[model samples]
Target: MKILPYHPSVLAQAQLVDLINYCQNTEAHLAIKMAEQADIFAIPQVYQQSGGNFWIAQDAQQIVGCIALLPLDAHTGVLKKFFTYPPYRGQPVRLGAQLFDQLLNFAQQHDFTRLVLDTPAAETRSHTFYEHHGFRRITPNELAVAYSYPDRHSWLYELQL
Candidate 1:
């Protein structure tokens, strides 16, 4: 598998949405309403053009994972849309971890002091992954008011870099 920076093109958005659907199908907790996900729908405006970036994990077969970093400010970047295709979701391939490491390396190089993300309370697997990566649970009140997550009522996490 290879992790590459996303390059805007006609099929880029479609590929991403397809990957999201693939993940959502198995992880019922991620019942994402595509229309309601504005940040993801407008990837270029929300991420690529706003001091942030998006990446995809592709193998010889297809895109197996995706991750994006949305800069909330000079010191912080919000990790977004992290999804791994079911077949490659865990060990052996470790696609999700590779995507995450790409995001982390980008964050550090960009001088981001912290990374933040929120997940639905039911997404225990994702929560554990983030926590294992040094993220600590934070109350909604602890997160800054400037950013709006799709799931405002979700559990929040922050990792100090």
Candidate 2:
């Protein structure tokens, strides 16, 4: 698999939506929510335009995963759209770990001191992943004003880079 940064087809890639849909379906009845589903159609504007980036994990010809980094302010960034096609998630594949490394490298290189993210409480695997990477659970009040989360009720995690 290869991790590629910045693709114009992000908005046109059906697999991107398919991957997101796959994740949602796993916890379809949960309280997980998005501020605006249409935001996917404006990735560059919502993310990159704010001095952040989006990445895709492609396996040969297929898109296996994706993640977005959105700057909350000069020193903070929030992760978004982090998803991995189930079959490539763990073990020898380690696609999620690789994607996470990319995000961390980017965060550090960009001089971001802290990284924040929200995961659906139902996604225990994701919670474990974040914690393993040094993220600690934090309250919403601990977040900055620029931090606007789509998941109204999510487990918040923050890592000080």
lDDT of 1 at 75: 93
The sequence of per-residue lDDT tens digits that candidate 1 reaches over residues 1-161 is 78888876667678777888767654554666678777767777878999999898887747778999999899999998899877887878888888899999999999999999988887788998999899999987888748777663589999999
Q: Give the clashing residue pairs of candidate 1, or none.
A: none
> Can you tell me which runs of candidate 2 are displaced by over 4 Å?
10-12, 26-35
- Deviation of model 1 at 150, angstroms: 2.5
Candidate 2: deviation at residue 112, Å? 0.3
**What global local distance difference test value does model 2 have?**
0.82
- Write the residue-wise lDDT of candidate 2 on 33-124 in tens digits: 34356667777788878888988898886788999899888999998888898888789898999999998899999999999998878778
Instruction: Assess each prediction's global lDDT (C-alpha) against the native.
Output: 0.84, 0.82
Clashing residue pairs in all predictions, respectively, total 0, 0
TM-score of each: 0.91, 0.90
The residue ranges of model 1 lying beyond 4 angstroms of the native Cα positions read none
